[model samples]
Target: MNLESPKVTLDKSTEETFNFLSDVKNFESLMPENISKFEVLEEDKFLFALKGMPEIILKKKEAIPNNKIVLGAAGGKLDFSLVADITEVATDKSEVQLTFNGEFNAMMAMMIKGPISKFIETLATNMKTTV
Candidate 1:
């Protein structure tokens, strides 16, 4: 299944925004307040957990400077990828949108659609203040 989050404008330039997301450590600030656990394992990988959810390990899969960053699950019951697309809108202003792609059975997908939807939305919203 696939889900796309609403585009959010950031005050920084695309390059700046991209740089911020390039480091795994920076993601800690972008996570929701409800995040139960978080740790940066390396420059390109991190582990995070939300309340009532199993811990997930994610690693950077692909990156296009000042354009995109794709993170894939490194270890989890589910296989998924999250892509961040960045676009320059004005001088020092940029837009970022997130897309989540997951491979899951119909039952699992149905069960997670709502929670995952909220999770990505929260991430996108956090970008506004945390970036």
Candidate 2:
């Protein structure tokens, strides 16, 4: 399944936003307030558990300087890629778009689409204000 987050205009520059996202630990700030657990396993990897979901580990796959950051699951029940795209709007402003691409069977996708889509949207929305 593929989900695209709502575009967000950030007060920081593209480079600044990209730099922040390049560090996997920074994502803890973007998670829901009710998250049950968050652990940084390494500089480029971390695990976070939501209230009802199993802990998921995310690892930094690539950083495209001032352009994008690619992250993916580090072996678990769920496999997915979370990409952050940064576009410069001005010297000190930027627009960010987040996309989630998950590898799921048709049955699983049909069952989790609603909540997963909402989760992706929430992540995008939070990034707007959090950054």
TM-score of each: 0.97, 0.93
- Alpha-carbon runs more than 4 Å astray in model 2: none
lDDT of 1 by residue, 15-98 (tens): 999999888898888888889999989889999999898899999999999999999999867899999999999989999999
Write down the worst ten-residue block by lDDT for model 1. 24-33
Which whole-number lDDT from 0 to 100 does residue 103 have in model 1? 87
| lDDT measured at residue 99 in model 2 versus the true structure, 0 to 100 | 88
The Cα local distance difference test for each model comes to: 0.93, 0.87
Judging by TM-score against the true structure, name the best candidate.
1
lDDT of 2 by residue, 39-73 (tens): 99999999998888778888999889999989899
Please give the clash total of every predicted structure, in order: 0, 0
